[model samples]
Target: MMILSWRRRRGGHRTTKAAFSEENLSTNLAIPTHFLCPISLDLMKDPVTLPTGITYDRESIEKWIETGNQTCPVTNQVLKTFDQIPNHVIRRMIQDWCVENRARGVERIPTPRIPVAPRDVLEICSNIMTATQRGDHKKCMELVEKIKRWGRESERNKKCIVENGSGYVLSALFESFSSISIEEHKFLLGETLSLLIRMLPLGSEGQSNLGSASSLRCMAWFLKEKNLSSCQNAVLALKELLGLDEKHVNAFAEIEGVEEALVKIVKEQICPKSTKASLMVISHLISSSTSSENTISRFLELGLVSMVLEILVGSERGMTEKALSVLDTICNWEQGIVKARAHALTMPVLVKKILRVSILATDLSVSAILKLCKSQEGGGDQQVEALQLGGFHKLLVVLQVGCGEKTKEKATELLKLLNQHRGRLDCFDSSMDFKYLKRPSL
Candidate 1:
């Protein structure tokens, strides 16, 4: 990294280096651009090569890794490890240049500290658990902060934390903090649960440690926090746990306040991340095989149908997909069908969503409509309302155009139901001509 100094002038002329003595280059020396690290854009004091074969100054690269970047700054290649190998030749060259320019005011850069070792991380985790056992909440938080920082520092550090018992320690911390019933400890409990969520990639063993009912309660408590980060992380952690196994999903059904918390979060629309996470939590609950009945019943009791319709009417494609998915699940149950039909916007939103958002939305929308219209013979007045609302035309267009097989089947079944009641009205089989179809106000 010994850089030659070349000064660019107004006319693009570089001042000659001939003015410099061999003993001291000018401190005002314009460093060569290549001599700078790609990330920090400063001289490479301790250069290191990533797996991508690109080099960066050690501190900048380590900070990037600590911030959870998985790719090289220059090449954008996935880094196998943040364990960067030192470019000794570059370091020596930088030192020599610094020595040469010492008389001119350039100071030599100090070497970087060594990377944290796995044994040290293990020791921290061991200390964390011991502190927790001794009821040392203050020391526990300090230890947890250390582990959190280490985990965020690099993927290697995260793996080390999980392997060195950080996950279990965090889980135990969650359990202990949640059971105390102290108001002040709530913040610490939320933080602990948040850490558990950050370590979710540790897979089944890590997920299992978080399966306690007390942990779920801790998340539910977080849902009530004024802090948006805590709420969002709690939602995310719940979603992650539900995704891990059926037992976990079923466990959610037993949690008394979670369904209501999620509904409130969705209705509040705090942020896109929290709303999406809350919707996903509801989706998983409804879609789970063993828990669908109980989950749907509880959601309906919480007036989830009305809240979902509100979300669906104005949501974008992503929200629409999840809303429709939950709606589709709800529509299959008798209680759900009763609630949906009772909702004023359910029919119109269902009709409007078909072919309006995405194929997945279309599929879920079609399934919901089929269930609603087919629940009774000729779908009763629902069929007439659908035809009057332009749902008849939408179903026909669904059949005429491209869609998935299940969507097509549901559409055909719905069309037959609409046709069964078509004779009652002056409606026509105007599947081909768009001009003949009168759109409903809804």
Candidate 2:
């Protein structure tokens, strides 16, 4: 497709004739934005060069090319530009780039860089501090010669943080954010957050040293900026970037509305996949944020309990481990969200799930239920029935069919719990395959 040259720039070239040129437009135009740029027509490199020896920014080319600038690649024509390019083209571009950048292997690896002297680094870090303090971010950035330089600078700045006063300067700048007009503050905060997030990653794989602790302080500070819409997004983006889903519990503790946002991500993104991978993330979050009782309660209200149960009994061991871990949080933790009160709990979904897993598989699950049953004077009669009718027999079989003596301890405890009704002793033992369970006294 042909494109008009730099409009007001010296190298600008405007097409004289018109022709339909978008031969690569995707087959799915109604998909909101896919058709904006034909996926089939990919530009491996940016500052796309044209057959006419002219080049334009990818975004600019996409805009003007859709306005009927379709023409021979060699000839300048006004075939298409905006009429063909829907208003959502920009949206498509961002989604496409962000997704592509996020997908592994799509990003090019940077070449290795030689190290700079520590004293030289200190001199440059001092300037970065001065520039950043004066709000000269551009000049500060120019100090780093390569991507690796960010780490070096971060380290140097951290070591002599007292001498350069970066911490004080940054804190002062952050204060200015709240007092400024919302729009301007947002823009400034957005840049500040972006820099902090990138600088905050755990140092490169197998690095000799860790990234500066000060960088973490900066990143954590950005996370605390939940008051701004963009900053909130930046914090979430950082969580995603570092795979620190669990960290948000603490990272976002002071940030208002983060719990709701995190719950939304799990409900919307994590649960939908239901893959062992997604469950891994959820499990990590549950473990990291041990005290998110409110969030865990929201999960059940969001109808996530069913999904968690399904994963807990699924064949994927990793997923089951994660799901069980989450269940343990709600059912066993000191401040559990899933209370022992089983008033209206008529459904046996949780029971069925535990029953489905191998006797050994529900080890933690059985423990969680046992913890739930513990009360002030100890579990009551109804709680005992809850355990029995809730299919606590899953562990009974572990005792009866003690082929591997897997739940030997658990089985004994469960039996003791059932010791309440000596007459009902037969009822509990009946569920077990005592014949196969006997692994011999030895």
Candidate 3:
């Protein structure tokens, strides 16, 4: 036993020396557990502490804050600020550990770069605003480029820029874009529009300012850009600016090519996110009571009903829901009802999504079908179409399964419309399932 123990010690020494050899060192070194961050489970080179007294690596914590979490990961307490104090002691201790283990192939952590301060961000933004107000396009562009670079560096810098009034400055710049007629200024206009998009998800006040006629028109120009990203950002910014206000909605509707641009964006299918944003903008515009008759007429002329039906078929839940909503709004108008009734796929898609999406989607589909069914001209043809497209079975299912009061009313009305024309279509007998069609509540 003694001989075997001595041989084991000798062999361990040989193994350690072999591991230290240049060819195999990388595989032998182990990082200390204390140096790893709790959130990422990796080495924490730049540790910082939150108000909740939890220390995390700077990058991870900043990203977490950027995602709009207000609570600390460890304590679940409200985070007063995303601004975390550097955990200098822990960072130094980690560095020292790396140094002590350097002979064993551990690499030392480099010093972290300094983050942008809020005061500096405020100063730059103030200068940009001043240049913008003075109509000094040259100086404004230079400073904007610098700030854009800083914003790209880290989310911390972006938060500082936004918190320091960069949103208002960008909005003001966008508003002034129309007046700058110089060819050089046109380039700045595109860059300014792109920057404003990056500044979204943070500024309601800036969005309100951007809803002005001139500013909205400027934003619409980007929708025609050859670069798909520019067009997407332009649409996204428009959607974000379109808060639930009649004034904003009306302003959007008044833009000349807004409807056409949205249709083009949807048809191109740039991406699902961009397509959804465009749909939302169109939905809001069509739904507004303040929108002019010309706007609704324009949508119908642009084949909006068929476009919405195309989107509803085999689309995502969100797309289906919003498309149904737009359909329902358009159907409210006489022209809209006519266009929808004329579309071949409208009733079929509407019936297909009745119980499949959500309660809201189901409700919108039923209401739209009812409008089509109630139309004076070609109402009988639409009824026959609905029954032929299996709407008869779908409506019976909705009635039997039960839905909201409004949905049930629309379903019952559609059934009555279909029954009145059942003899013409020659499908179901009138007495087949009369019990399922209960009278809707008043």
Compare the candidates by lDDT and give the number of the best one. 3
Please give the TM-score that candidate 3 achieves against the real structure.
Answer: 0.77
State the lDDT at 31 in candidate 3: 57
- Sort by TM-score, best first: what order? 3, 1, 2
* Cα error, candidate 2, residue 438 (Å): 16
Instruction: Work out the TM-score per prediction.
Output: 0.72, 0.40, 0.77
lDDT of 2 by residue, 119-177 (tens): 55456656655765676545644543332344554443334333333333333343334
What residue pairs are clashing in model 1?
66-153
**Candidate 2, poorest ten consecutive residues by summed lDDT:** 205-214
Question: What total of clashing residue pairs does each candidate reach?
Answer: 1, 21, 0
- Give the clash total for candidate 1: 1
Q: Which one wins by TM-score: 2 or 3?
A: 3
lDDT of candidate 1 over 174-276, digit per residue (tens): 7777766636687677678777776775455557656777667777778876788888888988877787777877886777778878988988999887888
What's the CA error at residue 17 for candidate 1, in Å? 26
Candidate 3 at 244: error in angstroms? Answer: 3.1
**lDDT of each prediction vs. the true structure?**
0.76, 0.43, 0.77
